[model samples]
Structure formats: structure tokens, C-alpha cells
Target: MRTTNFDFSPLFRSSIGFDRMLNALEAASRAETMDDWPPYNIAKTSDDDYRITMAVAGFSQDELDLTQNQNMLIVSGQKANAEDGEYLHHGIGGQAFQRRFELADHVKIMGASLVNGLLTIDLKRELPEEMKPHRIAISTDSALPESETKRIDTANQAA
Candidate 1:
């Protein structure tokens, strides 16, 4: 028995906007290289609410700061003391970390918290009706009649 594989060249060649898809794929591939140090979780708390939780074991509340600048959510943490005490054995995560998450348009940060060893950040997105896209009413007499069109043409020529 022989194994035969179907070719995908036709799909790639015929599809429109393949360049855009390729660019997006390249961007996502590059994003994989960035450090996701101190793994985190993003969950939808409610219809309009969201939360981000990061495992920050040794970092204190004072050491961590969360800020939203434009469309970027920046989380920065710096270890306070390099040598706190003389320990026979040390197995704790105590290193500076700065993580960046790109927020979509209209995504705003509501609040943040550091509880127990987890840093939880809350976010609320404004989903007003005005923000959503809608079609405008098209008038029936959209086209101008001959007399009014002639007047507009004369005015433009005079200017």
C-alpha cells in the first residue's frame, strides 16, 4: 500500500488577500518569541468585563505596577532586595519582569489587584451603541435635478 497526499497549492494560489494572511501569520510567529515569563491567564469575567492573572510569587504589591497607555497594557515588576537574608536553600522566583499585552481599540482597564501570589487585573470595555458601526439612511432624491446641477456647476466654475 502507498500513501497519497492532497496538494494545497490551488487553495493558496486562488485565495484573495493571501498576502494579508501571510503578514498576519508572520507577525503571530514573531510574537511567539517574546517572553511570556511568569505565565498568565486571561478570562472573561462578564459580558463587558475581563481579568488577567499572572503568577507573581515573590513580587510584592509595591514592586508591581500596571498601566494602560493607549492600546498597550504594561505590567512592570522589580524585585526590591537582592539579598534579603542568609538562606541555606532558596527556591523562589524573585526577578524583575515587564510584560506587555496589546489591547484592542476601545478596550480600557478598570482596575487591578495583587492577592495571595497572583496579580489580577480587571478590565471593562465600553460597548455603547454609538461605538458600533451602522449604516446611514440613504435619501430617495439623492441625485440632483438638471437645474440645480447646472447652478452648482456654474458656482464651481466661478470659484
Candidate 2:
């Protein structure tokens, strides 16, 4: 693996609470080529709904594993049995595979299903009440009872 370094000090001067984004960018810069096996597709079914479809032929539900940890999703598959025989042409790929996905905040896996050599995983982003945006109403002096506003009396203070 090759090592690469980047200076993000200039960006930090005007940005706040963006350290994680910078770190993610640096990590992506150093990441190597991803494996092409077990090709998958990610789609946005709705505003907050997502789906990940992976083609895992010759793998049963029991042979496949799916797990989520923090902000990461992992999917792996292994064949239960392997036949040692000479074949003229081997078409379908039955080798073991492990794939990872980086999930965003507030995203959760709804469910998963396997059918017809395809493994589909459903995901949804459900924001918490505290995280959702709220509208703030502005107030005017006429809308409130008349009350004397506090003032700093400079004359009453000692020099």
C-alpha cells in the first residue's frame, strides 16, 4: 500500500466542526482500489429510503452474513461445500467475498432478503426529533406586554 499525506490546515481556519470530513477525505485519498467481485448497486427509492442490491449467485441465505457496526455495514458470503473436480468451463463465481459500506448518520437497515441469486438490503434514514429542523417564530414589541427594558446606568456607576 502507498502512503499519501495532505495539509488541511488552511481549511481549518474558516471551517468549524469539519475535522471528520477532512479525515474522511484523507482516508479516501489513501484507499486502494476496491474489489469488483460480488457487484452491487445502491439506489434511492425515496427521499429517505435506500436500497443495496448485490448479486451473490450460488449462495444461500444461511451461507451469507450481514452485520452493522456503528456507521459501517458488512456483507460476506461463503460456500458451504466445494467440489474438487475438473470442469471444462467454470462460469458462476462461487468464491468467498466480503464487502463493506460506510453508512451515514441516522441511517438504519430496515430489512434484508435474498431471492433469485440477488441479495437486497433495505435502508432508511430516520432522523431523531432533536436532529430534525424546527421553525422559529419571530416576536415583535406589539405582541408582548409592555415591560421596561433593562439598561446599564453609566452615571450610577463609580468611575
Candidate 3:
């Protein structure tokens, strides 16, 4: 495999606490060059919801495994056994495969289902209350002491 050197000095200088992000990006770029077996699609179902569907034909739900560790989601499949009959020309692939997806912060897998040979995994981003955007109430009334207010007024008048 051909390797390319990327200069992250500029990014490192400007951003803090993003080492994981940069590493994930590098890993993703490397993984992108590999063959795409069992094609998949990531779709946004709602503002904070997403669904990832993979073509896992011939693999039973029990033969597949899904796991989430930190920010990574891993999916793997292995057929229990080959079909009893021999195939003259086998075309349908039921090979063992593994796929990994990097999840963003606050993203969590909601559920997963297998239907019609497709494995769909749902995800939702739920930000904590402290992380969510909030509006601070602005005070219209002054809370300064009378003496302090008089001093400010006198200073403004003198100016």
C-alpha cells in the first residue's frame, strides 16, 4: 500500500484536544482505499438521527455481531457453515467480513435490525444539557449601589 505523509503541524497549532479526530481521519483515509465488501449506506433519518444499512445477504442475524467501544462501531459476520450442496458456479458471496465506523461525540447507537438481507443500525446524537445551546437571561435593571451610580454619573458629567 502506498503511504502519503500529511502535515498536521498547522492543524495541531490551531486546534486543541483534537488528536483523536486527526487520528480517526487518518485511519479512515487508509481504510477508504480497501475493497468495499458488503456495500453500506449511511443516511440521515432525522435532525439528530442516522441509519447505517449494510448488504449482509446470506448471513443470519445470529451469525453477525455488532459492538460499540468508545467512538468506534464494529460489525462482523461469519457464516456458520457452507451450504450442503456443491455449487457449479458460486456467485453470491457469504465470506467473513468486518467493518468499522467511527462515531462522533454524543452519537449513540439506538438500535439495530436485520430485514430482507439488510442490516440497519440506527444512531442518535443526544447532547447533554450542559453541552446543548442555551440562552442566558439578560438583566435590564441595574444592581449597582446608589453611591457607585452617583460616582459614575459625576464622572460622566465631568468628562
Candidate 4:
């Protein structure tokens, strides 16, 4: 078996708090094979907003489960037992499956809906007020007194 190794050093240099995302990517690369059952689609609706849609044809809302734990979003489904008649050929897939998604910091699950056999999950990134960048007002020489201006000049000179 071929093992793929991912180098996340360069990504770590530019990103501040994305260790889990990079680690998740590396872990995904190391996975032996990709599971395509119950296919899903991830789309960015707008800046800081995302959506994940999966084709869960036979599973209802009660049979499906959605859980958000820290940085992980898990979606699983298990079909309830149903009366089986004589089937010529069962093509529709309803096997139990679980899918895990790695979410970035500040990304929250806004809502989820199951419609037309498609399960859609909405996510939005809401940065805290402290985390958002704010302009720092500069003290001009005219705004401050002589003593304060002198301190500002001294600080600038020292820098």
C-alpha cells in the first residue's frame, strides 16, 4: 500500500489557528481509500458562509443524526427496519453511513434541513469582536499636550 505524507509546515507559517484543519487534511490524505457512498457536496454560499448537501434518499429526519463536537461535524444515518416485499432488483442504497467534516475556528452550524431527499447543512463563520480587526486611533501632536506628545515622540524614536 502506498502511503501519502503531507507537509503542513508552510501552511503553519501563514495560518494562526488552523492546526485542526491541516491535521484533518493530512489525515484524509492518509486514508486508504475514499468512501463515495451517500455522496455529499460542499459549497461556499458567500464569504464566511458555507453549505453541505448530501443525497440521503431513503433516510428521514428521524433516522439521520447531526452532531457538532468542537471542530468536527458528524452526519450519520441508519435506516429503520421496513417490510421487505419480493424485490426484483434493489438499486436504491440505504445502508447506514457516517461522514465527518473538519470545521475551521468560528465556523458554526447555523441550521440544517432535509428536503427532497437532500440533506442540507448551513454554516457561518462568526468571529468574536475581539478577534475582528479594529482601527487604533492615533494621537496627533495637536490632540495631546506637550508631555503626552513628548512621550509619543520618544516611543517612536525608540522604535
Candidate 5:
């Protein structure tokens, strides 16, 4: 048997609160599917719009739940055997599945729908004003006189 270890020490840095970041990262890493149970696709719709499409052939809208917790978007489903059928070939995947997606801050879920065995989830990115980049004005009179600068330096040296 062979074993491997995950190194998380590199995430810690000055004042960024690495623990919080590490927690989120750990959750994301753990959510990766070992088996492609229910395959999904995420696509950009427009400049600020996005979409997520998942293949949920046998599950209904009532069997699925969508939630946004913290910075994570979770989609979960459970099938309740709506009909009894004797199958010659059971190729369709009908088992319940839960899918998770980590979303950046201010990302919003627009809507979700199931059509032709495909589950489509729409999302939009809404950036906050404070987080957006803005230009700052520099004042011409903000510069100090040379004599004032020298006096401040002399005081610092004296101290």
C-alpha cells in the first residue's frame, strides 16, 4: 500500500488570515468527485453572466435543491423511483448526487431549470462598488516645502 500527504503550510502569509483561506481551499479540494457521477458544465453567457449545466436525466425539479452558503454554491439531488420499469439495459445514471461549486464574492444565482435531461443553472457576477477599481485625484498643494521637509527630518534625527 502507498500513502500521500497534502501540504497546507504554504498558504499562511502576512495578515491575510490564511486559516480562512485554507478552510475554503480544503473544502473545495475535498469536493472533487472521484467518480464522474453527474457530469456538469459551466459556461459564460455574457460579459457578467454565467451558466452551469448538469446532466440529471432521471431526477425531477422537486428532487433537487440549490443553496448558496458563504462563498460556495451547492446543488444536490435525490431520486425516488417515480416509476417501476424492467430494463434490458440500465445505462442511464439515476442515482442521487450532490455537486458543489465555489463562487467568488458577489456572484449571484439567477435561475435554474431542467430541460431535455439537462439541468441548467444561471449565475451573474455583481461587483460591489468598494471592490471595483476607481481613480484617485492628487492635490497639487499636497507637496510640502523643502524647508518644512528638512525641519521634519531634523526632528526625527534629534528624537
Candidate 6:
């Protein structure tokens, strides 16, 4: 197995508070090299909405499990025991498997459903009002000395 070397020194020096984010990125990179069973797709349906679709062909809703802990989402499936009947050919994959996904801050699972051998999970990012950017009003008026040009001078000229 090939090893990866990443230098986060620059990020640490420049940023103030992003240790969790950097750690998550490193973990994700490591996980990318793992198995790819039960093919999945992550799609951004909208700006704050996302969908994760996984092909769980031989697994039913009762055989699957979904849970969320902090910023991690885990999905696993296990096939039930089979009867004494022998199969001439077993093409479909019914082996047990587990998959995990790291979610960003403020991202939460909306719902999940299994239909037609496909499992779809919906996610939404809801940022708090304090975290959203706000427009700052700029003071364009320049400060001038009161004695230099007083309002009395303008009033006298008008009179």
C-alpha cells in the first residue's frame, strides 16, 4: 500500500481555528483508498441540499441500518439467514457491508428511504444566523475641522 504525506503546517500557521476541519480532511483522504462495494453517488440537488444514493440491490429495508453521531453518518446492511434450499447460481451480492460519510458543520440528515434496490439519503445544511455574512455599512463622510469652515459663515453669506 502506498503512503501519503501531507503538510498542514502552512494551514496551521495561517488559520486560527480550523483544527477539526483539517483533521476531517485527512481522515477522508485515508478513507478514499478503502473498498468501493455497493456503489454510491453524492449529488448536490441545490445550494444547501444534497443526496446520497447507494445501490443496495439484494438488501431490503429491514436489513439496513442508519445512524448519525456528531458529524458522522453510518449506513450498514446485513442479509438475513437463508433456508436449507441450495442455489445453483448466486450472482447477487448479499454480503454484509458498512459505509460512513463525514458531514460538515451544520449539515444534518433530512430523511432516508429505500426503494427498488436503491437507498437515497437526503442532507441539508442549515447555518445559524450568526454564522451568515452580513453587510457592514461604511462611513463615507470624512471628518473635517469645525473651525476651518463653520456653518455660520455659510449662513452669513446667504443673508
- List TM-scores for all candidates, in order: 0.63, 0.80, 0.82, 0.80, 0.72, 0.77
Output the TM-score of candidate 4: 0.80
Choose the strongest candidate by TM-score: 3
Clashing pairs in 4: none
Q: Is candidate 4 or candidate 6 better by lDDT?
A: 4
lDDT of each residue in 1-159, candidate 4, tens digit only: 778688888998899878777878878787777689899999999999999999999899999999999989999999998969988998999889999888888999999999999999999999999999999999776887766554335655753
Higher-lDDT candidate among 3 and 5? 3
- By summed lDDT, the worst window of 10 consecutive residues in model 6 runs over 139-148
List runs of model 2 lying over 4 Å from the truth: 1-14, 145-159
What is candidate 5's local distance difference test score?
0.80
Off by over 4 Å in 3: 1-5, 141-159
Order candidates by lDDT, high to low. Answer: 4, 2, 6, 3, 5, 1
TM-score of 5: 0.72
Q: Rate the local accuracy (lDDT) of all candidates.
A: 0.78, 0.90, 0.89, 0.91, 0.80, 0.89
**lDDT for predicted candidate 6 compared with the true structure:** 0.89
Candidate 1 — which residues are off by over 4 angstroms? 1-26, 133-159
* Model 2: per-residue Cα lDDT over 1-159, one tens digit each: 667677777887889988777777777777789889999999999999999999998899999999999988999998988677988998889889999988888899999999999999999999999889999999887776556555689999997
| lDDT digits (tens) for residues 53-140 of candidate 1 | 9999888899998888887899998987767679887777677889987776678888788889899998888877898889997656
